[model samples]
Target: MREPADLLITDCSLMTPEFDILDNQYVAIRDTLIIAIGKAEEIKDKYEPKEVLEGRGKLLMPGLVDAHTHTCQQFLRGRTLGEYPMIWSRILVPFESSLSEEDTYLGAQVSCLEMLKSGTTSFAESGGVHMHKVAEATIESGLRGAITCSTMDTGPFIPESMLASSPGEAASRIEELYRAYNGAGEGRLRIWFALRQVMTSTPALITLMADKAREYNAGLHVHLAEHRDEVSYCLQNYQKRPAEVFDQFGALGPNMLAAHNVVLSDGEIALMKERGVKVVHCPRSNFGSHGFPKTPTLMQQGLSIGMGSDGAAGSSLSLFDEMRVFRSGLHAFWGLPIFDPVVIPAHELIRMATSGGAQALQIEDQIGTIEIGKKADLILIDINQPHISPTHRMIPTIVESVNGSDVRDSIINGEVVMKDRQVLTMDEEKILYESGRALPRVAVRAGI
Candidate 1:
C-alpha cells in the first residue's frame, strides 16, 4: 500500500564512495531523489516501478564530478597544443575574444553532450565570457554545477574583449549574476564568483570579488599556481607566493576551489592545508613536461584533491580519461617500478572524481555519493565489453580499465537523461553539425 517509485534499478554492481560494493543491489528513485536502496533480490517485488532498469552488467556509482572546467573553451580543443606559456596571450585571448554570446552557448552545449556521453553528470565550469550562455546550456543539457563570468578589472596583456571596464563593473556583474542565476535549473546550477587570475585581474578585483562571494555565500573559483612563471610573478609583485597572496586577502578556505596547483612549494601547500582550500588537479593539462602537481605529497598532507579536464582547450572533456591519466601521473611521481596501491589506491583515486569533487564545490552533503536521501545523480557503465571483462573488483575495474565511452546511461536528479549511450536531453546530430559549422566560423574569427 506504499507509494511506488518512479524508477527502479536492479542487479547493479553498486559502488559507493566508502568502498562498499553492493553486487546485485537495487536503487529506487522518485521525485528527483533516491527513495530506496537495498539488495536487488530482496526489493524486486517491494514496489511497483513505472520504469524498471535491468542493471545486471552495469556498474553504478555517483556520476563523475569535474571539479573545474571551461565549457566555453570546448570549441578550441586540440588547437592550443604545444603553445603553453604563451598559450593564453597568443591563443586563448584571441579565441575567447572572438566568441559571440551564441558561440559561448554553443560551446557549452557541445561540451555538455561530450560530458553526458562520457559519464560526467556534474561539473564546475570555470568562469568565461558570456556565462549566462553556460547556464542556459546546462539547463538544456541537464547537468549540475557552478558557472561564472571571468571577473577581470586590471592586468597586462589581457584582451580588451575579456577585460571589465572597472572594478565596480566586475563586482556588479558578479552580484547581478549570482542574484539572477545562482540557483537556476531547480537548484542544480550555482553561479559563483570567479577572478580570471592574478596575471589578469588586479588584487583589488580579487579582493572585491572575494568579498562578493562571501557576501552571497557562494564558492569562489580561480586558476592559480598552474605554472612556475606564475609563482615567480606573484613573488615579485605581491612579495609572496600565490597561496600567500590569497591568504593575505583572507580568501583561502573551504569556500575556495583553486585549480592546477602545479607549482606550489612546501610552504604554499602547508598554507593551503592550514586554510582548508580544495584543489582541482587537471592531470593531462599539466601532464608531460609541465609535470603533475605534487599530489602525492599534498594527499599525504590531507588536502582534499579532485580531478578535472580543464575543457577541450587543456584536455579531454571526459573525467574517465582524467582518471586513467591520474594513475599514470602517480606512477611517474614514484619513478620506475611502480606499485600502484602503495602510493595511492584505486578507490581513493575514484574518490577524487566523486565525493572529493563534491567537497571541492562545498556541496558534499547533497551530491557526490550514492546514499538514501541524497539526490540521485548516477552513471551506469556497461563493463561487459572485451576490455573490461572478468571484473574481479568493482572499483579497480572502473578506475583502471573503464573509459567514458563505456557509460551506457547517465541519470541526473532521478531523471534518465541518457540511456544506452544515447542522450535524451538534446539533439546530438544537430549539436555535432552545429559544432562542425561553428568551429570554422570561430577559427576564422579568431584567426587562429
Candidate 2:
C-alpha cells in the first residue's frame, strides 16, 4: 500500500546471489527506496513511474560498499608504497600532524571522487586526524559513509594534538561526534568509534570505547592482526593475542567490524564466528603487509567477510581491483581444481563489496541490496563496450572483467551522483590542484 514508483530501470541483467542473470527486468524506485522488481512488462503494468531508465546492454547491480578506507589518505597514495609497516607509520604519523583543514578537505574530495568514479556508493571511513572535515566532504560528495574520529593515546609515533590527552577526553570527543552527526544528512552519514590500533591503545581505553559505542548504538572499527610484528608486540606487552584481548574487553559483536584480521588462529576464527563479529579482508593490504591467509577458512566458519581497499597508501581504492586479486589469490592458495575459485564466485564478490560491506557497517537493511524498502543505492555498468561485449554471463563478467572506468553511472539515495563517468558533487580539478600543492609540504614535513 505504497505509492507508485518514481523511476524504473528496464531491459538489464540484474545480479543476485541465487542467480547471475535476470533479463528484461524493471526495478521501480521511489523516494530513495526500491519499491518493486520484476519483468519489465509486468512491473510497468503494476506501477506507473515518473521516469524510466533504459538498461539495455547494461548491468544493474547494488553499488559497491567499501568496508574499510581512509578517505583522507588519497593524497599519500603512491608516496607510502614499498615501506614496511613501521616505516609506513613513521612517515604517516608525522605527515598527518602537519595537515591543514583545507588539506584534509581536499584529500577527502579526491578520495570521494575516486570512489564514485570506481562505482562505490557507500564507504566506511576511518577519518584521520580531523573527523569533521571528513564528514563534511562525505556529505558534499553524495556518498554514504560511516565516519569515525580516529583515537590514539600512546606517546609513540604521533604528536600530542593527534592523540587524546586522556581516555576521558577521547570518550567525550566521541560523544560529541555521535550527538552531532550519528544520523546526519538524513541518515546518509553515520558516526562510529575508532580505537586506532591495539598496539597504541591501552586496555582501559579499549573497554571504554566499546562501552561508549554500545551506549550510542554505533559501530566500532579497528585494525587487528595486520602484521606479525603487531602480534608479537601485543604478545610481548599484554601477554595476549590482539583478538583475545579485544574479546576480553567485551568488544566482539555484530556491531564490531575489525579490519585486516590476517593472523587470527583457528580458535580466534571460531570466536569471531560465535560472536557474529564481522571482518573486512583487504587482500591487497594483506599481501602488501603480511601475505594472504586462508580467508576461505574464515568464510567456511560462517564469519561474515567483506572486502576493503584499506586506503590509497595500502592499495588503490578500487573494489574491482580487489575482487580480481581475491579471485586469483584464493585460487593460487587452494590449488585444487574442484575447489573452484569460482565457488566464492564473481557475483558473490560483487555482493561482498556491496551488501556484505553494508552488513559489516550494520547498514544492510538500508543501503546494501536493491530490494523493496531498501535504499536505491546502485551502479550502472556499460556493457556495450568491446571488451565487455556479448555478455553471456553478466555478473561473472562484471566481477572479473569490468574495471572502474566502465561504471557508466552511480546512484545513491535515489539521486544520481555520477553520470557518464562525470562526478557531480565536487570540482575534481580544484581538488587535484590543491592536493598536489599540499603533498609536497606534507612530504617535506615527514622528511620523505
Candidate 3:
C-alpha cells in the first residue's frame, strides 16, 4: 500500500550525527533525500524498495566533505616537494597560469576520481581557472562541489594572462560563473567567489566580490594567513594582519570560508569568531614547514571548522589521510605543548569531515547527517578487511587504521557513484591514459 523507495541498505551499523553507533538498522532513500531510517522490520513493512544492499559487515555513515581543494593542481603533483617556502608564487602560479582549458578539465577529472574513491562526496574548490570545465567534470563525476574561479586584480607573480585588466572585470567574471553554474548538476553544485590570496588581491576586488557573494547568497573563499609571508605582506601593505586587512575591505563575514589560517593573532581569531566566519584546516598543506594552525583555539571558541586535502599537487585529495595527519599533528603541537593527551578526539575528527564540513559550506541543512529529509550522501566502509577486522572501538579504529582503500561504496544525491571499489560515473583507465599523455606537455610548459 506504500510507495516504493529508491534504495535501501538493510542490517547495517550506522553512525549517527551525535557519534552514537547503532546496529541492525536500515536506511531508505527516496530520490535525493533519506526517507526512512529505523529497524529493518518496520522499514520493510512501510515501503517497498527497488534495490537493497547487504550492509552486515559495513559501517554506513555520512559522506566525507572536503572543505578546500584545488582541482586544477592535480597535474602538478609531486612538483613542489622539498621546494622553498611560498611555492604559490614561485611554482604554483606558473604551473596554473600555463594550463590550457583542456588541462583544467583533465585535472578536475583526476582529483574528482581520487576524491570519490577516497569516500569524499562533496568538496569546496579553493579557486582555479576554467571553472566551467571543472564544474562540467564534477557534474559528470556525480560529486557535489562548490566551484569558484581564481580572481585577482593586482600584486606580484601576476601572470600577464591571469591578471585582470581591472577589479570590475574580475568581479564581473565571477558573477558570470555564479549565474551559469550556481545550482548546476541538479543542485549538487554551488558557485562561490574567491580571492586567490591577500597578496594577490586588491581592496576593490575584495569588496566587490564580497558584495556579489552576499547578493547571490554564495560563500566567499580565500586563503588567509597561511604562512608568515602572507601575514608580513598584509602588515607591510595594510598595516594589519591578514584577517584585519580582509575585514577592512569589508570581506570578513559569515559567508567567508577561509582556508589555512595558520598565522593569526588572538585579535584576528576573535574577529573571525565575532563575524561568524567559517574556517578550513589543511594540516598537510600548511603545517609542513611554515607553522601550525590555531585549530584548538578555534575549536574552543566554537567556530565552525572543517578539514580539507588541499589537492594532489603537494598533499593528496583524501580526507582519510587528512584525518590521520591532523590527529598526529595536533597531538604533537597542541597536545604536547599543554601536556594534554587528547587534544582532539577521534569522533570530533569524523564530525569535522562530515557535519562540520557541511556547516562550513552552508549545506548542513541538506547534507552531513544520516537523518530523514537530508540528502542521501553516504559511504560504506568495508570492515571485513584484515586491518580493521578486530575493530573494538569504531571511531578510533576509523581514525587510526582506516585508509581510503577501505571505502567500498559511495552514494551522492541518491545515486550510487561507486560500488565495490569501482566508480560508475568515470572512466578510470581513460583518465589515467589521458593524464599520462598530457602531463609531459604540462610539465614542459610549467618548466618543472
Candidate 4:
C-alpha cells in the first residue's frame, strides 16, 4: 500500500477561522487534500508520517487569492500609469493587436511568478487574446487560475480578435474554450467568458454570453462601471446605467464576477446584492483611474466584496500592493475615531484576499480556507523580519508590515510550487528576459 502522503508541517502558528492563533500546530496532507490540522503533539502521536517539515517561527495561513487580473498585461506595467480611460483603451487595443502567442505565454509566466512569490496561489484572469497561452502558463506554474478570453462584438476601440463576426460566433468560441479548459489541469485551471468592457459589448452579445455561461455552469467575468466615462457612455447609448443594462440582459447573478464597480448607485448596489453578483474591489486600479467612486458604501451594504490587483498596467499584479492601497483608501474614505479608518481589519483583509475571493469565484468549498478536506493550498510567511517584530498581533502585523519577500513557501494542491522564495515550475530569469524583449514591440504598436 502507498504511504498515504506522509507529509507533516509541525511547530507552526496556524491561523484558523475559529482561533486567532493556534501555536505549535501540525497540518497533515494526503494526496491533494489536507487530512489533518491540530496541535503538533497530538497529530504527531496519531499518525507517524514518513516526512516531517519543521515550521518553527513561521506563520501558516490560507493561500491568498486574487479575484481579478489580466495576466497577459504584465508586459504593459508602468506604461499606462498616468493615462486616462480613453488613452488606456487606445494604448491597450493596439498593443494587444501585436501580441503573439509567445508574448502572451511570457507575460502570463511573469505574472504568475510575481503572484506565487507574493503568496497568491490562485487568481481569476481576464486577458485579451491568447487564452491558450494563459492556460498553459497557469498549468505550468502550478497555480490555480480561472482564465477568460476577452469577448466583444461592437466597439470602435476594441481589437478584431476580441469581437467575433456575430453573437453566434462569440458564443461558439466561448463554449469551445470552456469545453477545452474548464476542468483541465487536474481542476487547477477553470475557463470563464469575459466581456471586455461594458460599452464594448453589444446587448445581444452580452445576453448570449450569459446564456452560454449558464449552460456551462461557469462564471461570467467582466469589467463594469470602472470609470465615469463608461457609465456615461452606457447612459447615453442605452438610456440606462451600466449595471441596469446588465440587469436587463439577465447578466447579474451569483455566477457573475464583475470588476471595478466604482460608480454604482444605491439601487444598483442593492440589485447586485439581491442577484448575488460578486464585486472585485481593485483599489490600486481605482486610484490610478483618479475618478472612481467610493466603494465602502457598497461594502457596508452586505455585498460580496473581494480584492484584486487589476493588472500590471494599473496595479502591478501584486496582492500586497493592492492591500496597501485598500488600507490607505479605506482610511481616507472613513475618517478616524468613529470609523477607525481600518475598515477592513487585517484578518478580514486576508480573508477577503483568500476565502472571500474563493466565495466570489464559487470555489470556496474547494480551496479557500485551511480546513481539513480542503485543498492543501497555503503559504508560509517568514515573520522573523525586523518590521514584523513585537508580534503582539500576528494577523495585523502580517497585513500591515509583511511584503511579498516574506513569503517563504507556497503550496497548492499538496504540492510545493515555491520554496524559500524560489519558484519551481517556471524560470523567472527567462521570463524577465522575454518580457524585456517584448515590451519595446508592444510599445511601438501602442504608439507610445
Pairwise lDDT winner, candidates 3 and 4: 3
All candidates: TM-score:
0.96, 0.94, 0.98, 0.95
Query: Over the stretch 1-448, how does candidate 4's per-residue lDDT look in tens digits?
Result: 2334557888888888643878788899988888988885557777767666668878888888899988777888877866756755787666776778888888888889999989999998875778888888898999998888778888787677656899888777767777878778788989887787778788898898888889888899988888888878988998888888998998889999988888888888888889998888888878767444556676688777788988787556667767776776777666553667566567667777888789878899988788999999899888767998767887777767888788888888888888778898889888888788888886776566
lDDT tens digits by residue: candidate 3, 181-260: 88889999999988888888888888888888888888999998888988888888889999999999899999999988
Candidate 2's error at 433, in angstroms? 3.1
**Global lDDT scores for all candidate models:** 0.84, 0.81, 0.89, 0.81
What's the residue-level lDDT of 397 in candidate 3?
A: 86
lDDT of 2 by residue, 1-448 (tens): 4357777787777876464567777888888888788895667778777877778878888899999998767767877668866644686666677777877888788889899999898898865867788888889999999989777888577777788888889988877877877777767999998787887788788888888889889899998888888788878987888888888888877788888888988888888888888888887878777877667788788777788898887667889999988877767766455666455667667767887898998988787776778899998888889888786776677767889998888888987788778888878888888888888876676566
Which of 1 and 2 is the better model by TM-score?
1
Which pairs of residues collide in candidate 2?
A: none
Clashing pairs in 4: none
Ranking by TM-score: 3, 1, 4, 2
